[model samples]
Target: MSSLEKLTVDKRTLKRIIRELKKWKAPATVLLSLYIPPGRPISDVASLLRTEYSITDNIKLKRTRDAVQRALSSAMDRLSRMQKVPPNGLVLFCGEDMETHDFICLMFSPPEPVPVFFYRTDKWFHTEFLEEMVEHEETFGLVIVERDQATIGLLKGSRIQVLEELEGYVPGKHHKGGQSQRRFDRQIEQFVKGFYKEVAEAMNKHFLPLIEKNALKAIIVGGPGYAKQDFLEEAKEFLDYRIRQKIASELIDVAYQGPAGLRELSIKASDIIAKNKYAELVKAIEEFKRHLVRDDGLAVYGDKMVRQALEMGALKFIILDEDREDAEALAEEAKKYGTEVYFLSDGVPEAEWIKKTFKGLVGVLRFKIA
Candidate 1:
């Protein structure tokens, strides 16, 4: 499957977390902390918080170590009591407080040959971990994040990992303003095509290995000015269906710096999935399938069947065709039971609605899947 094809959050793993987040009393507080042998420096935790997190003053640990200790106590107590943690919110932990033996991190290398990493909060220490992991989208289960220009990984309970890092190679001319230069400025234009050629070569080299690991998803060419465009055209002939349509390949503009390239690539990745719309269809199809096979809070088509499912409390989600005028009656019924309804319109492109119901079909469910 393509990278876009595998972006689903496993419902079985997330159901409990969803349930608890919904049932927990209002004014809910999210707890972020670190678990140590109980003797690690509180400043380690404090500096970790000071660097990136911003909560209310009541949550700060600057002058008062006890404040940090108290928050840790509360979060752990809540974590242990609960069977699961919600994905909708984030909780941070660091230093000794984060060293729980069970902590695990989930890291994706986009290929198997590249090492896969996750965080082990209980076993190790890192300050900015949780923030980085969440950037990968919802495929990961419960965890904290950690990444910077050099590192990217997560801590589910405590899985440590370091993703493969490839620097963006630049020939001398690539850093300058592309190929725009005059004979008087010939020294600056000395390395025009060669610059992008090197970038293109490096990119091809970086992404080609994924096929060996069955992980090649797409090739994106990006850098400012003429460099990316030049590279794109140079690399155009090679975007075979395997990499273009099948692997989600593309060539676009992005910063030449390694870190900036990744951020821009992430945004482009999100756009590729979002603008394409097929990803949503694929997910909706799987969600419906889950409903059919596992009774995981979904019902489909017809008023009687939907209500039967809802009354059985078997349904947590409702899918409706916007074109169905009679939808009003069914919508009212589904809403009465706290069912979440999403419009599946026939007027929209059929490709978009293929996974959802149309022609008066509807889905009813018992819970929400994010």
Candidate 2:
């Protein structure tokens, strides 16, 4: 897959990137971040990488420059192979450990413009950018079921991952008759109960852990007929209290079953999905507005005040317009303070308002910053 196709910048991705950054110490490592704009010539990036590599050679170090040089060459080769850049462009992170002659690349097309920059630090690998990308991610669990079958999985942005599929014995509707038919009807009811119980058990086994970890925004269940609702009634017995509480919606009127039903349900419930993802951000913006109306010290805006709050370790959280040039630096500083950081994209109305009104940065303070 192309870099754009394979790359998904989410919370897990950020965690992995941060872990790598923390472990990558100096003396034997070289880190580089390059901005490859769309339709820009590969020769430009290659030339820049070569110049940086040459500069690294002159610096005093214990390890040989061979690994760094080889890594630069590999990055250049990879760039040359790309016919054109992705829509949002690419940010390439290349690192080489001289001791092991190991080279790694973490390349992706970021949602925001990644400023063209280079850094070779003891413990930095453009993790700030990763944080910015991850702040935009929203993930949730999805369940789709019919009478006899069900599919459970995760929804990561536009991607849908099927985690498990389950099938159970569901008999047809019973017809009216005498005593013999009544006994047969009771047997069918028992079978239906068993089927619902089995489906609920599968969901409990697969989805409960995610709910317990608080990894999902919510669990959205959908299926044809009353099966979705019927399964939830059984799930209450099988699933944990926390897991049961996480069910945001139980949808009926779905046409398909299994994986196909999962995808269809995603489309049908796009609004609810979007609401779950953006609700917190929207509320935060509203709270910031309330502070503004009251002229409270608890909320501050503009790049200067936000940075001041970060320096003082007074920021509870901060929001930045995705288009802001200084967002990456602000995010890095905020991370040090253990402050929550959110990147507001242009599509969001509040984000657009902030972009026009606040010069692209805002912070909710832990206390008055006067």
Using TM-score, give the best candidate's number: 2
Instruction: Please report, in order, the local distance difference test score of every candidate based on alpha carbons.
Output: 0.39, 0.69
Question: How big is the positional error of residue 172 in model 2, measured in Å on the Cα after superposition?
Answer: 4.7
Candidate 2 lDDT tens digits, 302-339: 76788787889998888877556556566666767878
Displacement of the residue 317 alpha carbon in candidate 1, Å: 24
The top-ranked prediction according to lDDT is: 2
Tell me each candidate's TM-score: 0.36, 0.53
Worst lDDT 10-window in candidate 2: 115-124
Query: Which residues of candidate 1, in runs, are more than 4 Å off?
Result: 1-11, 22-195, 211-216, 236-241, 244-252, 277-370
lDDT of 1 by residue, 46-129 (tens): 344344233334554442333334444444443343222222222333222222312222211111111222222122223333
